[model samples]
Target: MQLMEVCVIAKCTYKSETIMFSVSSESSMVDILKTLCLRFRGLQLGCFTLRYSVPSYPSCFLETDSDLDLMRTFLLISNEKTVDILVKDLCGISEYSGDFCVNKELIACEKGESSCSSTVEDRNEFLGRSKRASAKPLLSNEWETYIHHVGQKFDGGAEEFRLKLCKYALEVGFNFLYAGNDKKRVVAVCSNKKLEGCSWRVYASRCEATGSFVIRTLNNVHTCAGRIRESKSKMMRSRVVSSLIVDRIRAKPELKPVEIIHEFKDYYGIDISYYHAWFGKELAKLDVHGDESKSFNELVWYTDAVKETNTGSLCTLDCEAGINRFRRFFVSFGGCIAGFQYCIPLLFIDATFLKSKYKGQLLCASGKNGNQGFYPLAFGVVDSETEENWTWFLQHLASILLPMGRVVTFFSDRNQGLLNAMGFVFPGWPHSYCYYHLKQNLISKYPKSGYGKLLQDRVINLFSRCAYAVTEEEFKVAMEELVIVGSSKVKAFISDLSRDHYANAFFKGMRYGEMANSLAESFNNWVGVFRDLPVLPLIEGIRQKLMVLNSQRRFEAEKWTTVLCPEMETRLCENAEAGRTWAVRRSNSTVFEVFADYSVMVDLEQRTCSCRLWQIDGFPCTHAVAAILAKRDSVYDYVECYYKTDFFRKAYESPIFPIPDIGKGLGSNGSAAVVCFRQLQRGQPEDHQQRGSKFLFVVVKVDGILNVGVDIGQAFNTRRF
Candidate 1:
């Protein structure tokens, strides 16, 4: 009488998973599916559950009642697509006889729960299986204990709270491990790794414990102070590494000298090597942070250069302290000055250390060319007169003049390493020690010794002789007295001094004195005209200084012809008569060639010279102007070319580019523009049918005609009419 009920329990196993369920007589198939879905939250029973879960049922299906509807819905949901399942019955059956039983225990009877527990236990079951999950013990075994302690310390769950703490430590290279009981757990771990420029020298496995919740307690320990301490530890290690780099660089005897690559700026980001201009203000005094600070911007660098130039070729470096931080800024633009190509060769070099400005260490060089006057060439600052320092200076100088050629000679006070480095840099050219340096050293050795006087006189005579000594014996005899001096240091010095190849090479008619560093001191004279001033004023002052030098050289290169007068005209006529284009003047006439090709006239009777080149170039007696008047040539034709622009240009050319921002990627919530458009469209839902700007974009013609388009999904698509 129970409507001929039939209970079909399918006993089947799928991959060791048993499929079994008891079907009720009164309940519909839909009800059974719904019950099954509810019983196993983790399982997926298709739309069979959805059919019974919803309200309305089809009239054709209602005639069969509960079980039939349940079966129909099951068939529809399991056999049809998910979308089609919704169409089968938007609402579920309204009436059901009795409840359907579809518990998980009903399935998987073959494999006992014991077997499941022994093999692969579910997450919740595993959590429950930890015999001591709730038990309070004396010590915790894992990081979970600390996590639990932290949570308990803060009165929160150990699971959700521990992840954050663990993540933070891991980010900085510390892994958390557990070690205490549940009653009073500990959050502890050990670190032995170096991450983010840090040293893990304090390597020790340790532990910490807490009770209940402890987020705040842990967070307080992980403050910025903690980060900074960690960061500083890393930096200390890094400094050691940096020092190692400097040492390794110094050790390589075969390595080339260090070059002054480019002039750095303080404020402005752009770095210009050739033509440079900068404007900066006093953001802060030199040691705003403290004496340990040495930070500086591009502007500060320019300002320093200006000030140092005014201070006579010497200025101390300044910057921020702690960790040796330099200024930070963006590189906007960079380009060479128009006339840089014409100015460089006259580079003056000097080296100084942190000690007294005058005494720490110093090296200087001067250069001269066919058309230029005395010019400063190279200089360096170093801790001492050590081989490394000398090599550093020479290498840097060589790099600055690499394209110029090694034929260029250098003059300096004879320091051992300086001499060695010079030979390494320009092996083919002469690296001469200054005569004054030699003379002074000798005097130091033999203060009142008649031999010292005699030696000095002999040296002066040979140099003034205007020619190389006829024999090497002449130099020996000249040094005969100093040679007799008792001091071995003096003897050795003189011996090295007389070697003719090392220190004495310049003394043997090598034109070494002509390359003396005296003019660099003179150039400093021109710069010291303005040194102490604020940033803007200093820059302005420098501009004037550059202009002065530029104007003077420009004038010299173009004005020497005017200095020659009537006698030159007469000689030209005579030469014209002789069918010659140019005439050579005689030396016997009271004429001297002054610097810059300008001749100075000297009247024999008056003994007065008429040109200023003699004063500027430090060359007198030979007046080109006087010679021109007396039908004789002048010596000015051989004046050095330091005044030429070409020498200045080569000294400056460095590039600067901006550092890129490497932060988070932009706009994660869809394209910014698209999101805005969607928001706008939602605001005008009443006009949803309208296209164009209302939805995406609209183009309007100059005549006011509108072109509308919908993007659909393609971003660049357009429709116009």
Candidate 2:
């Protein structure tokens, strides 16, 4: 019996009576060697005996274990020729005591005498042929070759490789680990399973993403590079500030501050995830600090940057609100109006709704002089048209105007708030209700009947007369013809007025000839340009109107001064005639001049400066200015009494408004016409729906499907779904 020697490979081993062996035909020698190294402690034996037995075949025993192991090792390590020599010397390779007779058959088969026969030369030829695995280097020593091969696999199936790459990138540590064969136009990745079914699938990673390994090849790495570059370029497109400034630049080319940013998107594509990356960096630069303490940045920039830019501003702000919106103009109880160097006594007051589309508060104001044409001087809005709103409005108004002088009188609508707010601010100041509102209210209650006409005439007459009405009784008699009872709306209105302190004072002191709030009505009519507008446009319109009005007023003032200088000189000469009428006058140490309008006489010594012109112009009117200057009084005193500090301060006092207690009004209910319809058959798909005749009655299903019928209403019947 010939016993083959066994060779042992391990890191370590313990002596034992029996020797253990493991063999595999599927793997090459190197694979087997690596597996042995992993399983055992150390290489222990050079050779060992072996015996083989199979259920169908016979058994084989090695004569000498050392010779067999040596021969096997030689077969593994040597070329074909050397293996042949070793195999020949080690004949009787499958010796079995019981199979000795059958051995002759195997020998015959080996000699090509049977179907499984093969000549020794032929066997050697088979042994010498390289196996598929043997043709390739071991994976450990051939990393580059592996990558290249895997890359080739990807090239063979590009889309499949891409899918694999995407899946792997989503998994393993290598967000992406890929190899490219630019010349072959292929890209490959190593992941969980052979990507696109390529050669390599080494998915070893510490990432917990997912343990899916795949090796995949992709076609056209160049295309990927180009796309990536395009994507990057698109990502780096326009900056934030530049983008924001683009519209501004386009709108006003002359105002362009810097480079223009054309478009944020690009040809390849846009990645929304990358927008913040680029925009954030650019926006940070917008936090610029400029020189001016009250610079535009503080106001417009701060709000625009922090709030407006991030969100968005109302589009109509400047267009509507800035250009056409009304602002409140206020004059203190005793404040004088001023224009340029002249002070005027008259104050025109009114209230209008805010133009902003947002539910804006009300806007009340003192109107500008004729020259300025109702330019608003101050402004405010409130949640409601209440006494508080009016009071707050008046107080703020008084503050703004009073510094100029005391407001001799104020004109506004008969709104309770206006009256109450004034009273709160100026306890004892004269105020006038808008004549239009008063007239409208009266006309609404009583048409042109004798009594209505008489009442209207009387109210109108009271304001037009010269002497301020002296007593409440005399004022009452003027309206004696009007109805004064539960059936009379005018009578109730009058009675209500009598109860109001401010209104009472106004009626008592009403100068029969003085025109009331006609000017305010006109001003309000002009401001109609701004009604019911969106916020941005409303604000913009108002601002623009103000700017234009102010600019025109300033221009007119300059023109009036230029044109009337010589005329005033002549007036001064005439002033010298009557007790030496001086062109200028001094009143309580302040000087004023009277200009134009030759109507009233100017008495410098008496401090009786008139032209009533001062009231109309909101300035001293050349005559008053001239008169005051004659006395060398600095021509400042007669500056409209309203402009004086005492009066000006009074304008700041709150105005008063009388709020009516809310209650149900007469006749609350009413009815109007309406229409109804229904549908009939439905569910089945049809080419088109039949149109129903105008007056035809049709049965309609609850679902709105209609069916044609002679009288659908009478024939209506419910159907189960």
Candidate 3:
């Protein structure tokens, strides 16, 4: 007689799944369970052992082939209506195998309820039951939600995470199972959602490493299911979300929270809130720029490092008197000192507002080198552009400069504090207001008057012309035009303005024909991006930029072929070409008269022109050029040293050494180190920067081993080396 065959339904309450498989009365229980596990592609029956638990029948473990048939007889012949079958993992979580269709929709289901349609919305959760195993979509979220409810759902407020994880596996189409106790089952799902088109099965497992448990995806769990498709579980992991947020932040720091929420739905197939992305970005800033307060505290060491690395570099970090936080500070490395030697004597000092927790102004003292590019001499951060702060800035400049015996002209706006400070600090030096700044003040003070734009334009243009006028005659001509326009108030203001400081005719020899502080303004723009950084980072960033500026310029100069710098050569060529129509008649071997529309005297011997261009700019004017060419003299010979390629090269010869962090988390104001730039003169008060050997950093051992670094050279030491 053939062995009797009977169908048993194994219902999985978690996935809302049930399977029907025929079993023979003679078949061993082991074979029955093995066959059942093999049929369900998405189920990991290995984690569970089959058992027959019924009221009449003592809970019997069908551990052997004989036990299967013995239980089949009881189901058939006994008066029991059904046999309560249970699949349980010895360790709660049975092993998972894709070789069987465990997590997938009933591929062989000639039986019960099936999974949701493959045609769910991109935003929909795609893993639950809808209709019978024959067809149709999974049930609504109400019924599907129970898939997340493991163990006893209606039991108090507690729910099992194993079933919850089972729901996640169903959602993502992963081949895994929760194989622990229902009360405290460990949920193990496929960690790598990227598993697709592969023969191997992988599950997420938490294992101990270095005394800490880290989640890892282990492969080698084989699955007969064709190829697991790529899908993300609706279950969102904290780490996974954070990591993706970090990537998006680095790619687009301006990415908003709403975009992140949509990103989870679109790219990740998961849902996240807007606030999550916002808070995540806040955390990301720390990862990218570091903690702001910690960086501020590190400025002391940062300053020390600049002095140490750049040798003759000078830096001063002064905090508020009582609060002992950054108030006003200045730094000018050795390269700045060396560069200034070949630069024009004019210094443009100005201040721009800083955007930080503490409102302040960034004061920059900049000059123009032979290349006519901004030569940042020093930078200071001040609470405001007060007289004391400006004085402090100029005083630091004076300490190194006065000892050199060279009085440098200063070009600045008529900032009351800066003007007052300049008069006191460099009393002998000529201080001029930036005419452009004056023009701005004029425009701001006198808004659109009854004078239409035309008149407004005329007044502004006339004032601008006054700044560039090479002679009092030229300035007076513009001034008369302004007065002709009938703005008596403007005329009076112009008349009161000292031509020496604002007019090219007056500041001719003193300021190199420069009447504006555009150089300082440009310098402010040069390090504008770095100003937003914390104190230590801002200083380090500025220091790094200077190094790049020095290197790039040096490299550029090496490529120049002209005796004069590129810009200077261009100027001379233009001027010489314009002087082509000049009528030059030799007065003597060294003198000539150039009547280029106007008669002017050019004395080559004195390196001067009656127009004063040659003397004031230190470069031959068109008149001087015409005279020099008339006598068969080289025009290059008439140019100033300040315009020479070699002089420009000298300005960048000293290196702006790289500054680095000596230690981590060096907080602000807690430590102190004295820094000097251009060391001070001996027998003098030692708190100033002086002209000395370009770079010398000396460190004295403090505790026989550790070094206390200081910048000291004969130039700044009270006791000479």
Instruction: Compare the candidates by TM-score and give the number of the best one.
Output: 3
Which stretch of 10 consecutive residues in model 2 shows the poorest summed lDDT? Answer: 83-92
lDDT for 3 (candidate 3)? 46
lDDT on C-alpha atoms for all candidate structures: 0.34, 0.36, 0.61
Candidate 3 residue lDDT tens string, 302-387: 77777778777678877546433345678888888877878777788888866433335778888788879888888886656667
Instruction: Tell how far residue 697 is off in model 1, in angstroms.
Output: 65
Off by over 4 Å in 3: 1-283, 320-323, 445-451, 484-497, 662-721
Best by lDDT: 3
- How large an RMSD does model 3 have? 16.5
Tens digits of per-residue lDDT for model 1 on 355-384? 111112334444443243433333332324
Ordered by TM-score, highest first, the candidates read: 3, 2, 1
Write the residue-wise lDDT of candidate 2 on 530-639 in tens digits: 54333223333354564455554444344343222333334434543442343333344543443343444455444444543333333444465455546556554443
RMSD of each: 32.3, 30.6, 16.5
